[model samples]
Target: MARFIVRAIFAALGLWLASRVVPGVRVDDTGSLILAAVLLGLVNAVVRPVVFLLTFPVTLLTLGLFLLVVNAAMIGLVALLLSGFHVDGLLAGIVAAIITGFTSWVAGMVIGDAKRD
Candidate 1:
């Protein structure tokens, strides 16, 4: 639970960063940013795997590049579901995905899985 909260915070940070750097990715306020982060996490966890499975052939054909589209779609899905968080198009969503993914990667590195004490 604690770890989840931390990761969510990092995800919000990523979204904030994306809003600043990506032209079409707009997060209206801190509240929207936080909700979007949690929603994005849920979308990634639940929807991404199913979408990946469905697009496996295309993913293979594209030599893993299609994964970017998948990520963008997930971001776009969040935008569709959340009013205050908006992604203008596929390109902007893709950029937001990249920024968020990099932010999560660094966060994971810094907060590796902990062993039971």
Candidate 2:
């Protein structure tokens, strides 16, 4: 429970960074940013695996590059669900997704290392 909350916070941090780095991604406020992060985490947990399975063929054919599209779609879906979260287009979504993923990965690594020390 606490772990999940921590991860959500890290995810929110990633989204905040994305909003700063990506020109076409906008998060209206802190509340909306956190909500968007939680919603994104839920969508990724529940929906992403299914979508990944369904698109396995294309993903394989693309040598895993199509996962970026999958990530972008997930971000776009979050934007649709939350009025305060906006993704201007697929390109912007892709860029935002990449940035968020990178930031979140770094956060995870830092947190994981902290636990070990």
Candidate 3:
């Protein structure tokens, strides 16, 4: 539970970065941004696997490049589901996803390690 909450916070930070860096992505408010982050995490956890499995053949055909499209689609789906989050188009979604993913990766690298106490 604590780990899940931590991940949600990291995801929210990613969304915040996305809103700042990606032009066509917007979060109406702090609350909306947090909600979108949690929703995005849930969507990735639950829906992403199914989508990946269903698209496995194409994903293989593309030599894994299709995963980016899948990630963008997941981001777009989150935008559609949430009231205050908006992604202007596929390109925006892709850009937002990349920004969010990069931010999350950096944050994980910094935060995942425990300090000696």
Candidate achieving the largest TM-score: 1
Q: Which 10 consecutive positions of candidate 1 have the poorest summed lDDT?
A: 108-117
TM-score of each: 0.94, 0.90, 0.88
Look at candidate 2 and tell me the lDDT of residue 58. Answer: 100
Candidate 2 lDDT, tens digit per residue, 1-117? Answer: 665677788888878888898899999998999999999999999999999999999999999999999999999999999999999999999998888888778767766755565
lDDT of 1 by residue, 7-91 (tens): 8999999999999999999988889999999999999889999999999999999999999999999999999999999999999
Q: Candidate 3 residues 1-117, lDDT tens each?
A: 555677788888888888898899999999999899899889999999999999999999999988889999999999999989999998888888888888667766766744542
Candidate 3 segments exceeding 4 Å error: 110-117
- The C-alpha RMSD in Å for every predicted model, in order, reads 1.7, 2.6, 3.3
Report the candidate with higher TM-score, 1 versus 3: 1
| lDDT (0 to 1) per candidate | 0.93, 0.89, 0.87
Give, for candidate 3, the lowest lDDT window spanning 10 residues.
Answer: 108-117
Clash pairs, model 3 backbone = none
Any residue pairs clashing in model 1, and if so which? none
